[model samples]
Target: MSFQNTASFPGAGIPEQVSFDRKELSVILSLYGRMVAAGEWRDYGISSLRECAVFSVFRRTAEHPLYRIEKRPKLRNRQGQYSVVGIDGQILKRGHDLKTVLRVLERKLIRAVD
Candidate 1:
């Protein structure tokens, strides 16, 4: 009997586990870089899961994350794909355009130096 190839073949390259794209990453990193230099963020983590992709920012490696940038492709048509969540699990913003949604974080960067 001839052997049939299964869908989960060993040599098959698995698709991406997460949804965030290059343009999304550029926006996230752009803000992250500034926060890093400003001493507001010290570390970060990336998680690509079946449901969503997340970029978590932290003030320290061992502490809880300060913020999370998530891409939920499933929500693209309804609420949009990009979202920024706070440490308390509150959604700070959500939108189709990454740049616009990220503006909230930029606002945090502004301050008055006395």
Candidate 2:
């Protein structure tokens, strides 16, 4: 029996995973910290997928995420690369600028503090 060598295939070794960069994470975490301090958010999860990266924010560990921040590089030119999704699967905001997209949640944070 002969087995085919998978290593000979092009792009076989490289994983096409997408994830938040240092600067992006820095911006997200800054908001997360503020929300946590205000008692609006608690648990969080990060997922790096082949197509997009997601940062999910949760009020509790077991419950669904209150929001999802997604980065889709493919959408960079079409609808911007960054997006904020609400719990109901609605696109809260979308833009090329990460900070601009996150401002939706920041508004919530302001309301949360009030």
lDDT of 2 by residue, 2-114 (tens): 98865677877666898999999999999999999989999999999998999999999999999999999889999999999989999999999999999989886655334
Worst 10 residues of 1 by lDDT: 11-20
Give the residue spans of candidate 1 off by over 4 A.
1-16
Q: What number of clashing residue pairs does each candidate have, in the order they appear? A: 0, 0
TM-score of each: 0.83, 0.85
lDDT minimum window of 10 residues, candidate 2: 105-114
> What is candidate 1's lDDT per residue for 91-113, written digit by digit as tens?
99999988898898898789999
TM-score of 2: 0.85
Best by lDDT: 2
